[model samples]
Target chain A: MRIGLIGTGNVATILGRKITAAGHEVVQVYGRSAIHAQQLAAELQAAYTTDMDHLDPHADLYIIAVADAAIASVAASLPLQDKLVVHTAGSVSKEVLKVASTRYGIFYPLQSLRKEMEQLPDIPLLIDANTPDDLALLRDLALSLSTQVGVASDEQRLKLHVAAVMVSNFTNHLYTLAERYCQAEGADFSLLHPLIVQVAERLQYMSPQDAQTGPAIRYDTPTIEKHMALLEQHGEMKELYAWFTKSIQKQAASGEL
Target chain B: MRIGLIGTGNVATILGRKITAAGHEVVQVYGRSAIHAQQLAAELQAAYTTDMDHLDPHADLYIIAVADAAIASVAASLPLQDKLVVHTAGSVSKEVLKVASTRYGIFYPLQSLRKEMEQLPDIPLLIDANTPDDLALLRDLALSLSTQVGVASDEQRLKLHVAAVMVSNFTNHLYTLAERYCQAEGADFSLLHPLIVQVAERLQYMSPQDAQTGPAIRYDTPTIEKHMALLEQHGEMKELYAWFTKSIQKQAASGEL
Candidate 1:
């Protein structure tokens, strides 16, 4: 498929390269920033465009890989009529692209992507479309790039997005707080790296509840008190630590484990 | 060096096997439960004893791997006089073992251990001692089992323990909540597995703050509100989402990132 790549952010850059590698020709790279558009276009050996009105209508599919707030505006500006158009935003609805083209869908890659990553990480693609043919086309395009592909409605995709935030964003935030705490205490944060890896690795074989361990689940009040006392200097981290500890204890008390 | 393994829980079982694999003799396994002690002893090819007074006196090092609350009591029951004794509890001080033996130290493996794990994960061992010679001896024993060894004071080890709970236990709990959310939505929880792995893998190369990406960091109010609405039925998760979102926004506002 000939693709018109929209935006030149992390998602666009990474997915543009992936689409090109998957044997789809990215005919044009579009960005508000001329430098980024030109750079990505040069990398893909494609045309570059900063004007939304000048998006290559010759391309079979147009992918809007911009921020959630910009997806609808970008779709509204696109000049395509019958060409299949899609936005890569997880929270945005597929109907946002209806104004852009009759044949519209979604090609949301459910992963934390960064263009600076040396190698492509495994991305699970969640797709949706207004029509069966468009859905199949997006599915085929997505399957070419990722083995884990699913057809999800706007609601389902949003739910998964919430879950993704918990697992990726919120979990990483916990790490950030821990790193800060370690730095303050003059302890090496890297020492906990193995434990982090092992905990995540265990999820492949066991459920997270089964994989859960530490003072929280054990309800070791002494250890918990000690930890709370140590975090007195970090107000936000202290509150978060208390919140998470209570949540764990609540789960345990409910006999869910 | 001959070792006396105390407690037959996950830590004791794993460390016992690793010690034997590293060519140290596990002369005896002691536990309050005879069945557990006998089972672990059989696996390590060591003698089993339910009575703490009957523990092997010839063992060079006695490792107390038990619950944090039980460590002090267990140490008090041990018969060792001048032999080097260490309690593997991270929060427990080296002084806890002073009653059990003249030579006391800490040999805390800073990793989440489970007996059912098919392979031994890389465990960063944190060692501490009351005397210089005993510290050297503990360090040698720790080095045999793990390449990452450090001499940490009691306070430092406790701080690391707090951080370990954040990265491993609290992170896993986030996964647990996400899994629950996915289940409620009738979405496949495993779909987020790659995302979880990628977020953690990136931590090896980048700090968590640098790697953070989501509606929270972006302060994307519309998306955050949508997520909060979706999580309306999940009171605990809804509260957590709001808390984390605010925390991330606060961090961003502070120009920490």
Candidate 2:
């Protein structure tokens, strides 16, 4: 299948490599930067273009792996001639592509991508197209690369984005906090990793509510009070402890904590 | 070894059962309530006691797995009589046991323990003691159950506790937040999980700053504006977006983002 690859960022570069490796031919590569487009296209032996108008729209499919904000405008500017266009953004609405053509959809891969990542999984592809034919085309395209494919609505994708924040962004903050707190105490943060890994794994079998441990959940008032004393310097952490304790107590009352 | 376990709470119950399974006898079970004590003692085939006088200093060792507030008083009151005594708390200073006995330490199992979670891997155990022999005894005891064991300072243990909060407690709260937001939008939260796991695995290889994705990290102003607009109702989320963006920007600037 011939592919019109959009953008030359990490996701675009990674997917470009993956798609080409899967025996699909990338006919054109577009990027906001001319040099980046040329660099990526050169690697894939494809045409490179900086201008949106230069996009051929002649390939079997057009993949938009650009920044989410640029998607709608880029789609609007592209002379697709009613070709199928897909944008890969978790929180962006599929309707963003509708302005360009009704034969558009979302082709989101549920993974963090980067230029240096050596091993990329045949990612779980979440596809949603406007027409049944387009859906079949996207699904068939996704099936060639990934075994896991599902149709997700905008609402479902947004919900997933929120969950992603919890486990990913917010969870990473915990590691940072641990590192900071350890540094403050002149301790090695690495010592706590085993504990971190175990607590994380426990969540596999148990719900977060049931797997919860520590001073907050137990209502260990003295220790809670002690931690609060130490956290006085970090107002955010102090507020977090207070709010979390109250939240857990409320959840406990509801048979959730 | 004959063991006297104080506080028949969930931790005590779990430890009692596991120790019993290890073929060691829990000679005495102490609880704040006589009924709870008797019930736990019956389960472990041990004698039950509510009074401190029955805390036989004759037992090979005493494990105090009680609440943080009660720990100081309970240990103070127990007829430790220089008997080996250790408290199973991550936050509390092991010095709390010094008043009760000359031979004491801490035996903190570095994993979240739920009531029904009967089996656990050899999660790294953190041990500390007031004397060499006590440390050896605790070390041998921990080694008997798990190969992963180490000694950490009280300050380090507290940092671990704080990290535990960020990962387990705070992460769980984020889940709750996502659920609330998704529910408000009629979104399916499950779709976000693979992304969450991806971010998590990414963190194992890269620092949080490097692993950071999404509009906030990408500096995609339009997408950020859209997400900000989406978060109009949640004032707290708005603040989170702004603060986290600022923080990530600084880290990204310094860390080659």
Candidate 3:
């Protein structure tokens, strides 16, 4: 399928290259920034355009990979008739693409993407459309890029997005805080890397609740008090530590596992 | 070196197998439960003992791998003299072992251990001792079991323990909550596995602060509000979402990165 990419940010660049590599022809690249559009288009071997009106109308599918806020305006500005249009934002609704074309859908890649990554990670694509035929077409297109693809309604997608934030964004925030704590205490942060990897790895084989082990779950008050004493100097981390400890204990007590 | 393991929990079972695999002699296994002591001793092909007075005094090192609360009692009961005694509790000080033997230290493995796991994950051993000679001896023993080993003071070890809880225990708790949310919302929790793995894998190449990307960091109020509305039914999750969002924004505003 001939694809027209409608953004040049990290998601756009990574998806553009991936789509091109998947044997789809990325016929045009569009971006508000001229230099980024030109550079990405050159890398993708596609035509470049800064104006939304110049999007290649001849392409079989147009993917709007712009920011979530800009998706509506970009969809409104695209000069396409009945061509299939999709946006890659997780939170945004698929209905926003209806302004760009008669047939619209979502092609959300549910993974963090960076343009500089040498190897592409496995991206689970969540897709939805206004019609069954359009959904089928989008699924076919999605399968070309990822093996892990699923059809989700707007409500389900939003829920998945919330879960994604908890697992990825919030989890990484804890890591950031822990690294900061390690730095402040003059301990080597890398010492915890193996533990980090093991915890994530164990989730594949066992439930996270089963994999949980620490003073928090055991309710080891002595250890907890010691840690609390150590964290006294760090205000934000101390608060978060207390919050997470309480949360874990509550969950354990509720027998939610 | 000859080793005696004084516990029959997950940590003791895994460490006993690992130390035996590392070509050291596990001379004896001791526990309050005779059945558990026998089972672990049978697995390691070592002698089993339920009586504290029956511990192998000839062993080079006596590793107390019991629970945190029982470490002091176990150490006080151990019948050893002038032998290296170490407890495997992260937050416990090496001084607790002073009651067990003239030589005392800590041999804390800074990773979660599960006896049922088919493959032994890399365990980073944190060792500390009362003397430089004992420290060197413990380091050699730790190096035999794991490639990643370090010497940490009691305060430093406790700090690392806190960080480990954040990265492993708390992170897994987040995953547990996310999986529960997915189940409640009728979304496949396994779909987020790739994202979880990638987020952890990227930590090796970049700092979590540098790798952060999400609505919280972007301070995208629209998405945040949408998520908050969806989380209304989940009281605990909603509160956590609000706290983490505020925390991430505060971190970003502080320009600590």
Best by lDDT: 1
Q: Over the stretch A71-145, how does candidate 3's per-residue lDDT look in tens digits?
A: 898888887889989999889998887777899999998988878677788899999989899899999988999
Candidate 1: where are CA atoms >4 Å away? none
Winner on DockQ (2 vs 3): 3
As a whole number from 0 to 100, the lDDT of residue B213 in candidate 2 is 67
Task: Report residue A95 deviation for candidate 1 (angstroms).
Answer: 0.4
Model 3 score (lDDT) = 0.89
lDDT score at residue B104, model 3, on the 0-100 scale: 94
lDDT of 2 by residue, A46-118 (tens): 9988887667857988999988778878888878867888998888899988877768898888766777676
Span of 10 residues, lowest total lDDT, candidate 1 chain A: A248-257
lDDT of each: 0.90, 0.74, 0.89
Which one wins by DockQ: 1 or 3? Answer: 1
For the candidates in turn, chain A alone yields TM-scores of: 0.97, 0.87, 0.97
Indicate whether candidate 1 or candidate 2 has the larger DockQ.
1
